[model samples]
Target: MDELVVRTEVYADPETVYEFLLDFRGYAHYSEYLREVRTVSGDGGPGTRYALTFAWWKLTYTAHSEVTGVEPPERIDWEITKDIDAGGCWRVTPSEEADGDADDGSRCEVSLEVEFDPGSASPDALDLPRLVSFDWVLKKAIPLIRGEAERVVERAVRDLEESTRDVDLEVYVDSDRI
Candidate 1:
């Protein structure tokens, strides 16, 4: 299993960022790969479970997630219980330059952790690259998977900035690293 981490800064307090992530439904508008997410049980805190669906062109995959941990204004983490071995998290804190509810200075970092072997039983990983599809990815899917995943996350950050109007969310994408 390989792990990839990509982070972006948002001009919102830790709590605000936390809230945004807590509402999984709002993420549908963020990435094309994400179809929609709905709560299956409990509040969004730890132990909460969600029914999530994602797609790449003609291929679609569904999975259930149980939030494993939550630390308000700091971090939140969850584990995927089906289809794939994956996890996600967000880390928020006061930006060094910003204080109070000014919105301009406060920032939070978002990260997603994925651990899946291409040789795994599921075809979800190979089908993630809409253009590359299963055959090419199955042959050597690492680069293709990583690139597509990064693009998905990048789009999410861009969408998050556009939706977050109360603050100037400056999201930085690292093209050099995915």
Candidate 2:
């Protein structure tokens, strides 16, 4: 039930960011933690399911994700179906200054939320030592408690930049999955 929220301003329009968020197939290309991501059903909107396999803390997790909500060029929410109960959303909007020129590439701000406990779903799992808490291992690896989300956001941004670079500019800005 723990939650971490991250917000970042990118050099892209809100629409561009929204469409990019809809492209689930590009996750593995963006974050190394995401070992694989493929559509299981639907497209990128509500009911669209995705099979996601990722590694964290030397363990691999496989989960099914479903898009739960979509508001177009603004917000998209999702829910996890198996493995772990976790989901987050992308909120895209023009920055204050960009309000006057919404299409300017640098005016968009994106907020990402990632909520997860990172522990086994079974209650008995926590009874075993070194089985339920991520605090210890993460602290040893990071100096600050909030650093994990920062790292996630940093890597996500870098991945987005890299993925966009490989695509035609117009595609990222126009095509939903290009």
- For all predicted structures, in order, the TM-scores are 0.68, 0.67
- Please provide the root mean square deviation of candidate 1 (C-alpha atoms, Å): 5.7
Candidate 2 whole-model C-alpha lDDT, 0 to 1: 0.64
Index of the highest-lDDT prediction: 2
User: Which tens-of-lDDT digit does each residue in 10-97 have in candidate 2?
Assistant: 6666777789878887767656567889899897989999987766656565668899999999998998876556788877877766
Candidate 2 colliding pairs:
none
For model 1, how does the per-residue alpha-carbon lDDT over 5-111 read when each residue is reduced to its tens digit? Answer: 65556655667667877787776775656788889998888999988786754657667889899888678888887756667676565556445454454566666
Task: Assess candidate 1 and give its TM-score to the true structure.
Answer: 0.68
Candidate 1 residue pairs in clash (backbone atoms < 3 Å): none
Using TM-score, give the best candidate's number. Answer: 1
- Model 2: how large is the Cα RMSD against the reference? 8.9
